[model samples]
Target: MAINKLPIKKLVEFRRLSKGRQQTFANRLKVTKEANSGGGDYWVRSISTISNAFRVNDNALIKAKLEEVSNLYNAEQRSQTKKMYKRNIDILTKYQNFDFSEWWPSTSLNFLPKPQSILEMHGLPIQIRPQQIFSYGAENNQSVGGIWLITWLQGYKDEDLGIYSEALFRYLSSYYSEDYIINPAACMVVDISKMKVIGYDKVIDGEIPSLLDASIAKIKAHLN
Candidate 1:
């Protein structure tokens, strides 16, 4: 049987937990997978709302989209799903006026790129999936593309953000070619709740890769 793929965020958290908690977390990962046969759409509408605002340069769309999602959630039959949707909407409502200027200076962004292929971690079962990819600058700018990995998780320290940024950059380097015009400096993690933009500006200097590999190895052992 194929091994279940663990999200990068879980892998990051796994390394920080106590040994006992690690096992509990690994078990929870398994239980979560078995409980939900398909991927969750908890943040789909919210993310689409934000992405659409950037794509169309209309901040008003954020409020409008949230209203649409809120109505749908109210009518949802599944309690768990409805709660997830409501939570996402509540978070978005707080930052519906989110300042895109913090991430990009351009007034308008180019068309949203097609989703990138899933990033496999060097023969490991772990995968890294970026939430959004966009390009901005002069209409014909060559170095306009950027990768933004959105995380709603709160209380992440700067150290954690650095690790995420480095991991994302490594994955982007492996998967995308020059044709994509991906700006290494533009690669970042968007901490929505914190309203902060973080990038791998200060390279952790050869430590992050080893740290990630070790974490993945431990996670793999737990999976077995």
Candidate 2:
């Protein structure tokens, strides 16, 4: 699970607790990722405030310790994250001219063969309708949760097909956890790191997404 604000602290605090108190801590973490990870402050606060009403066995103290840890770590993470996000926003915005905007989709004049499209350094995703989303999980169809990278077919008809992901990719670093990314083609399933591009095979005739994925993989390999 993606380590969120309070879990690490809560876990650490639990270690300080006596065995009985530790059991309570264990129960909370076991409840759900959302328990400590979800960002709604009201929800987070309720866990402790409500527990005070029922601190039957060192519940209140353990909880208070956990909250302290959570708040401290979250604050630190927020500060560090803010700096990184600002850096990201600065870089992404500085390169806005290179975005997948149709204004200039060809390769740089300095380069030969006039490149078709440029890859945005930031990773971005398309906002296809629920109906338009093409889901392909593992062989068992068990590819649950987590961000999935994807590629798309571009042609004369789709100039910006794999360029910039969306209009809001730049500003997102300010308020969200995602690290912005842009691949030359929309043909990858990557995590937050933005370093790996998943490969794909095509369906002979012409499945747009499939073809796009395969082409993206080929080009990406050469670039690396």
Candidate 3:
């Protein structure tokens, strides 16, 4: 359903399977609002990976070929084949119209606005701000990475509000894939308003075993 995030090292090798076409798509992917013609290895790899992983058939290749056949000068000679191919391609093309390459990393800066909105919607403090975020180590490094935030909510008074932690995790997990956030390298929760360290956690293996509860607990403990 989604293109999951791979480690920088793994993503590099994966993209190489397309002989650097992944980079080309990556370049076009960020700014482009929609899928277009003229794809490369990245596009092929994404379709292949999703098809195999999800046990679904990807007919984009077939559809493109069928369209080419339909446009041939002697298409009337192979009218039966053309009709059948057109029927199938048209049905499959709807699902295939979307590009999977866009999922490899997020393409929208809208993710930045969600935390504050969700927090406000839940009546939590509005002072939350991102301290550090993760990246895929590219030229722009636009992928959503780990998040560290400084918040004004007094941990001692609001430590029981699991909603705060849940809101952050939910927003990130929803926009980005669960694979993108399986583990964050470092997450620091600080209280600069009081000039203190609320809590800090780093995962060598990048695993968030307990999700938000783990981070919330660590930071709350510091407040105690």
Clashes of each: 0, 12, 3
Determine which window of 10 residues in candidate 1 has minimal summed lDDT: 33-42
Candidate 3 lDDT score at position 68: 58
How well does candidate 3 score on lDDT at residue 123? 21
1-224 per-residue lDDT for model 3 (tens digits): 01112111222222233535554544443345322322222223223333332222234554554465346524555666555445434433443454533222343222333333222222222223243334353343334433332222222222312223333444455555533442232232322223222222222233222334343332223223
Off by over 4 Å in 3: 1-116, 119-134, 138-143, 146-166, 178-182, 185-187, 194-224
lDDT for each residue of candidate 2 in 1-224, tens digit (9 for 90 to 100):
21112221232233346757655555554454222422323223323332222222233443454455455545665676545434333322322232221211122111111111212322211122100111122333311111122221111112122121221121122222232222222222221122222311112212223333333233223223
What local lDDT does model 2 show for residue 4? 17
Q: Which ten residues in a row have the lowest lDDT in candidate 3?
A: 1-10
Tens-digit lDDT string for candidate 1 (39-141): 3355667666665565555678878878887888989999988887787787578667866555663556554554443455646545555555666665555
**lDDT of model number 2:** 0.27
TM-score of 2: 0.20
Alpha-carbon RMSD to native, per candidate: 4.4, 22.4, 21.1
